[model samples]
Target: MHSDRRVVLEVKDVSKLYRLGNIGTGTLSHDLNRWWHKVRGKADPYAKVGTINDRTEIGDSRYVWALQDINFKVYEGDVLGVVGRNGAGKSTLLKVLSRITSPTTGTLGYNGRLAALLEVGTGFHPELTGRENIYLNGAIMGMSRKAVSARLDEIVDFSGCAKYIDTPVKRYSSGMIVRLGFSVAAHLDTDILVVDEVLAVGDADFQSKCIGKMNDVSKSGKTVLFVSHNLAMIRQLCNRCIYLENGRLHSEGDTDLILGHYLTKNSDTARTFEHGPIRKVEVIPETESIRLKCHYKVDRIVHIPNLGFVVNNQFGSSVFGNNTLNSGMSANREFPAEGVIEVEIKSPKLVVGKYTVSIWFGDGQEDFFHEPDCVEFELIQKSTSQFAGSAKVGSVLTDCEFKISAL
Candidate 1:
């Protein structure tokens, strides 16, 4: 589909398999058989023996395929987002591209140098200082000492660990380690960058900074393969996305459409509790306020201490939250066997973006029903404000009159 653009990476029929149990007894035989087939230019014999990776069920075979018949292409300067549920073959695909592991079948063709930060402290030595490891990683990437020295200061400053540059990596916290690792990988002049969910180890501010750096990298005409559970980041940082499910390519297309599909597929609406006080939960978005409705039925008197919703933006940041206790509602009362309770959040001014709502019902310490990502909706600007082009961008909007005073 990207014929007009030059391809940077190509993956064809890629698959990875792992033995389920112990690896001692029949491993040698399988390895010898694989080598025999390779010498004869035949397909891998074990490729036909593995089952699809489904964590909820046990398969008949002893081997499982982490990836199967996976295929896609990454054009030069493309920021590709890889998304799926846990154990969905995302990391395995990246490892194959990074050459940390070879596919059991098929092949990968990539041009230019590639760098991967698949985990925190992936290529670091615990005994080495941060400064030393920077060069060490550069050396491992086939760069000379003089070449690494040219970008050493930029890496240290971007990592925000300049003061700890001389300290051994063992002393750094997990966040610091990730910061340094990402800084090195991003600044090493690699044509292709592979990043996993390891960015989650850093704090919120650091994560934002790293996203900004990735944006710069994409603008500089390099290729990026980013994998994360944070769909909002994927939407903002990537122009194209790949949705992998059950070790296969489910869909691949534009960022917004793919994310919509992913969110719809992973919604937790089917959750239920046995004989619980609550019966239903719903969120209705209105122009002025969001209407939350909770229907319930009870045989005996029941008291609920807390009940309300929490709103979060795309990056999973909590925008606002409220509960019955904090709103001065009673917890020592009973409700009708069949009745509806409604709460209105009035004048919730928010920016133009998608948001998710989580509803909870129970006491402060204990929960009767807590549903996350129950509803997702977008807020759009009805009219462009005179100040819309201003640099003060934020998720929340407020109505205030502007005044100017003479000096």
Candidate 2:
């Protein structure tokens, strides 16, 4: 992939401005001004002024720049990972690249056909059958009927939805629709693929399959722009990464370095309430399961506060967790001003990786204290598997034994 690489896509100063307000034709004066600017070959007055896209704050201008000064060059056979917090304009960037929407400013130059899976069912008509949608997508991509017919069997087999191929896509589940949609995008004759959080909707096996497919595509001298919150998948599939923050390109370059910066930025920021103050949290590994102990100070005497913990993998996806009430256990004990609570997870079946723990102190209905990143630990197996560290499919590794018998 590294040999004889050339730039396949170039995005220069791309910015998308969205006006916030009622959706309708603007006042007559504004429309005339826009037309006048177009006649004079001048920039639209509205494009010059816009606030940063911060949903939490109110700006003087009704317009917001969803993307600002975003520039990147993607080379042939490069798997570029785009990552950021929610509302970071990752999807907007992809939409612009896919030509589903045009940027308010700047230009994009690229070579070859581009295919995107922006959402679960972006191109499909709900009333159409799965089989019909495949053909429709091919037509939309400007492919001949013969071309799509040749690949129909491969698409159907990859989707694992042959049984429902003739059924209306509206009846299919989200996961099934994603499988069918991804299979089409992957098998199409496109030089570049833009995918947005496709693994977020798929099952563990399906996610593994999709990652493998993307890997194969990269190997075939194609470009991929992947946007995902799943850092593990990004690290696995992407050779380059771009981090966007507040609708702007914050950092771009190596994958591991950028991911490290992202994790550090989101490490510690949890809301606290009047219920209690958690002093410290620790996760200790044991032979069977891990032990999570919380040392806290209770300000006032409160009835059994529900104590729970959530474990998130390095990709920032919640893997496994349990609350006392949900687990059929009640901690209705009176709390002193200061105390320690220890919860032991039985058979913690997590794959070997670095994981962050988020602890919660709630009163059944409301959260008293929430710590997003209370502790971090690595899960290591005492013994390696027979395959010697083959990529684990998902975050959890269930306990089971395999046996073979003659039929």
Candidate 3:
């Protein structure tokens, strides 16, 4: 599919090296050594000694390669998704592409103007008003004052910060900064948009708007590079995906194919026990409630066996949890040697998505059995409410009553 499209960006043999424990080569001697190598037209003396950027393992080397030997081509109008574990160089790659940092080893070729939102308040001056920062960003992107002025109202409205547009960005909350930053980047006259996980700081509504804006940008023949851990958003936005591991491009291809491989490789199956007391578990989602059924077998007698479970979203964050004792249920007698335990989570305001269930069985004194990600299910919205298809903010929905009164 990429064969027919024009290549808007190309990354060739790119790598970024950083010295451990200190910035810029760590010492005067090391800096001199690197300078000496550069004067002699030799490759970086430290670059060769840097280890791959793997945070899990302790390495003997003092230098680490944040990104190494990366190569990829982004076609015009392509929405490329970058996925990786936390320290897998996704951010480094985007920084290199965005020109926030230079690659240690290779070059980046850009066919058009590039704008990036790598962090909250990435290009904003804290003392500057949000309105002023918008113009500053436009100026940085090489846009004229008239052009920026033409889009100022649209940008401010999209950001939802009109009430505080004249206030200094220092006083703006993190979420507000993100809203303005994203709005400026999207509305600016840039040909390629690069966004990191900074969108995670925004509320769900802003995130949905950012996603929609990126889609519009792509449809307008601009390229986009998105880095996110949210697989759902990645699947929804990207047509092509690249998986990074240990500072390298592990694989790149169709989004679903790459996501499947990534999930299979990084699945939390290792956290589950092989021979636990809980023999089987099932998580079934219904219109109004979620049903959790656990079948267990135990040889020893357990007094007042308490059954508890936690529901985690796809990102492994605990959404909510409940147990027999906490829910005002009484199981004072001894538990059966073998039996099925059924639990109905009623009226849970869960966002529509996939979730995993982790179970714990124990008495009031101690925990007897525990398993993480024991079962998985999807929550579907059945009510025909006005906000049914809107992007949800967090893991669970809130039931709040609103009141407006005049003094």
Q: Which candidate is the best by TM-score?
A: 3
Steric overlap count per candidate: 0, 0, 0
Candidate 2 regions off by >4 Å?
Answer: 1-3, 269-407
Better of 1 and 3 by TM-score: 3
| lDDT measured at residue 363 in model 3 versus the true structure, 0 to 100 | 73
Candidate 1 off by > 4 Å: 23-28, 269-407
Clashing pairs in 3: none
Q: Candidate 2's residue-wise lDDT over 1-407, tens digit each? A: 44578888999999999888998536889889989998999987887778997766888997889999999999999999998889989999999999999998899998988989999898999999999999999998889999999999999999999999999999999999999999999998889999998668888778878888999999999989999876767777788999988889999888888877776665442233344567777777566888888887877555666778999988899988888768655564555667777889888777766788898876678777887866787543333251223335688776679999999
Q: Candidate 3: RMSD over Cα atoms?
A: 6.7
lDDT of 1 at 403: 100
Tell me how candidate 3 scores on lDDT: 0.85
Candidate 3 segments whose C-alpha is farther than 4 A from its true place? 270-354, 357-407
Ranking by TM-score: 3, 1, 2
Tell me how many residue pairs clash in candidate 3: 0
Query: Which candidate do you rate higher for lDDT, 1 or 3?
Result: 3
lDDT of 2 at 209: 87
lDDT of each: 0.83, 0.83, 0.85
Candidate 3 lDDT over 366-387, as tens digits, reads 8888777777765433332424
